[model samples]
Target: MIDCGRAKRPGWSPSVHYAGTAIDLLVIQNLDEDHVEDLSELLRTVTVRSVFSNPTVTASALASMKPDGMRTGVSTAHNVLRDFGPGLIGRWPDTGEVQVVHFYCRFGTHFTETNDLSLATFFRWGNFTILFGGDLETAGWQMMLRNQEFQRLLVGTQVFVTSHHGRENGKCAELFQIMRPDIAVISDDAIQYGTQEKSTQWYRDKVKGIPVLGTENAYGIRDKRHVLTTRRDGTISIAVGAWGNYLVTPEKVQNELTLGEILGAFGRNALSKDSQVA
Candidate 1:
């Protein structure tokens, strides 16, 4: 998993269910408490072969240094490029099922927050590609776009997880242009950020009427297929298969019949039977 939420959320904890399983690559995009809450507990419980994080900032390192002037926690983080580059992690020989996990971690000289240090990653197999922007904002995206290598990697992205929870500051028109995504997902709570209208426009303008799906539907329904939110739909899962075929399953609603409706149905049935008999 890329990131784990803080233990504060109601009825959600990875440690309870996933602690015993082996985690091949635990990539901590940003080590800020919010991004990495309960990570220490997670590391203690789970068997992680390796962990990848951005280079430790000078300020964070200095602040964390002990009074004896010994630097600790140095062994926990490995630079992304050194650890995992653009390549295939594994493949099934018979069916040719492949796993393509790529990492793009870049930062400018003068950093302030962990968000600036987020890593951009993507997973691809067959003809489907899903891009995870890792909470990257305007400045971080601008820096990444400057690199021609990054642009080449972003083309033909089928799905895009919007950066920084679909906030306006995270909007990078160039990134959307490069990805040309069919659908975009925003991982934000309802009204936690601004209106989805702005976020929708960001990608629609670039890809020509592309749908921007948010985790929360603060605004009313625009189009059932275009603008969808998880608040109403609950959990959304997408299954991708060969030749770029994929299926998305959204939450369903159950219908219950009232007594009046049941009686009305019986009356209509009786009338139909009488007409037939006559």
Candidate 2:
């Protein structure tokens, strides 16, 4: 029962997908590889029963990814069904899941459409809420906040993946206050683009005392910077770090606590007296 978690496997833990929960990503944009590299990895390994992507992937590119000539014989109109778009709904009876991934609203604007159309996703996992705000810009968050379904998915978030690598300019300050996450994961490598200071601070500060894991430092699954790895043998949680530390417990509080004054002496005294008596 992980009330909160990150991809911090010690010696060896099973893939999160095997934990009997759905995994969803809020794809914020369709640009560089850093943006989509993780996407490809997740798709390749995870048994994604269903996927929710914004109507952002270009038609040609998406078609190319499927097995050659996979979408053959389908008319362009019907192909659109096979191809997802903004405001699209698809059912997965095998998984018993319904997916609704939205794209940015387009009445006549291009600038707003791109940034605002970031894929904002919500996953229901065993009564816990997980929100993935893809490179969701400020306006996108605000707009979704007004929608009933969006608001419903956002309340009491457990794991909130920060958008755009936690950028500051995306007008995401309000997000810092609203989705007070218990634990936040920032999927950024040590690259110049994804780890910009202003961009990732919210992921650092959005939730008070939230644990933040940067990919560059954690999973050297790419660059040998992995602070830890899981064990496949025995208890399966045997993780030895480069710093000569072994992970005994997987979950640790990773945030700074800020305390505000309790103004009422009467209330404070009552709690103090109870603690002393106990």
> lDDT by residue for model 2 over 158-183, one digit each (tens)?
55656655555454666655566554
The lDDT leader among the candidates is 1
TM-score per candidate, chains pooled = 0.66, 0.47
What is candidate 1's lDDT per residue for 254-276, written digit by digit as tens?
A: 12334454334334334231110
What's the CA error at residue 65 for candidate 2, in Å? 19
Backbone clash pairs for candidate 1 read none
- Model 1 poorest 10 in a row by lDDT: 269-278
